[model samples]
Target: MVPLLKRFTVFNLAQCEGLDRLAPEPAPLPERQIIPAAEALIDATGADFRIGGERAFYAPGPDFIQVPPQPAFREQINYYRTCFHELAHWTGHRARLDRDLSGWRGGPAYAREELVAEMGSAFVCAAKGVVPTVRHADYLGSWLDVLREDNRAIFRAASQASKAADFLLAFEGAPEGQPAAARQSHSSVQERIAA
Candidate 1:
């Protein structure tokens, strides 16, 4: 059986900062490699995405991943990765992993989750037969700056990545272990986070 945590394992390999807190355990979540049911996850989550359109839309739920729209397939993939990243963030919702996206929307909390999801999406893309972005130089400056400010931000990212992975895994009828962090009871990650 494919372990659901590999989604997180891939995030860790991408250097997700915060999950370090959970490292002492032996199983050590799965890595960036494809788990047994990657396709199942794609289907179960109803994660089908459109190729071209406007940048943003109003969705009633906070589980939507917002991507900047464009024409290039490359841009499409970038946004696709970003959308997965946001979906990764939304996975932490109270009904699911219950991550606090609301409190940290535009702040460091939000950025940290973005980083985790960014890495997680890259990992998932690779496993699902797409290429991971190599233009991380574009992200390093801001990411490092954020990391410098929040000592524990990495930990939060790790937890969020695991939560995202759990969310993906749940789609496959996989087991979900409670993430290391306690989720906020009320509010969506979006309502708590950004515009």
Candidate 2:
């Protein structure tokens, strides 16, 4: 048995910002509709994606991405984030963009590649109307180390990320109400942003 507190704890509700009232939950999309949109987006890139029990990864040998089953993520969005990250790596496969994917972990090359993948993921998320969040905040130190080592490192990574995003989104066809010239100009603006 445990002793009970003599007084009840209290919080000053007025001081609590944004919690005065409960916000309504978003209307949930059907699972079948949700999964296929992302799946089709991935499939459109011509890369094989599979569900696995292990940690997610992009296997270069067979050019496929292995993601843990949907249940592995706390939220549906997280699974897609992981998928986009791995798919960014998939863009580096020899038959694709051909990046130097042979780097060992903890090496400078590995750090650079990780930077590319992360930025690429962010770009893809933004394109797909998903707000980007830092999925691997722990890797910030490694990324900072890489950036400190090379002045142009971030530029190159951003350019590659933009290209990876463009490559993936291209399969979705044109954006509604946007003309081809506008799209091309937007890409040019993105390239300027890299500079």
Candidate 3:
């Protein structure tokens, strides 16, 4: 007869002699270096950044990004992540990507814009070798409701997000011969939305 093996959802290694040695210890968080590519991309936008506040936001009227100071974050990477998210919103300025930024908080339009920002930030973070996390968990319900209402909502949001990411990334190591306006003119936000 074959010997039986037992499975466990929770196991106590200390219950068995010498089994404690086999238990794995938790790993430490890796030290991540600041991404210069992300920095260059942000600088290229020429968007004003105010870096000392409790909340993070992109003010489209003035075309500025405000983020809490670096020291306020538990992990330095989170600070950059927040900045990238706001920068995604900054791309929607009338002079840039020309997205609809007039949505009020807790509304459908707001949820859609938040989705774009979240995905846009993920794209930029991935390009810069940084992991992305959801910055707006409270919007989860609203996002789901929007998705449930329209089958194509996600596709539109994704297309818009890709455009936003591309716009920001274009600023990184831009060619000296091309002016910023000319670079931004290559894609029309309205045309993309209509597709």
Top-lDDT structure, candidate number: 3
Clashing pairs in 2: none
Worst window of 10 by summed lDDT in candidate 3: 132-141
Question: TM-score for every candidate vs. truth?
Answer: 0.52, 0.66, 0.69
Model 2 stretches astray by more than 4 angstroms: 1-37, 132-142, 174-195
Pitting candidate 1 against candidate 2, the one with the higher TM-score is: 2
Candidate 2 residue-wise lDDT, 38-112, digit = tens: 655765565577887668888878788899876655566767778888988987876556788898366777878
Question: How many backbone clashes can be found in candidate 1?
Answer: 14
| TM-score: model 3 vs. ground truth | 0.69
lDDT tens digits by residue: candidate 3, 10-36: 756776787765777866545554677
lDDT of 1 by residue, 1-195 (tens): 676755433343447666667656565323333333443554455433443455532131544444444333243445445555555655655665565666464666666756776655655655455553545435634775767867777666765565465455445443233222223321233333322
- lDDT for 71 in candidate 2 is 60
Give the best candidate by TM-score. 3
Candidate 2's TM-score: 0.66
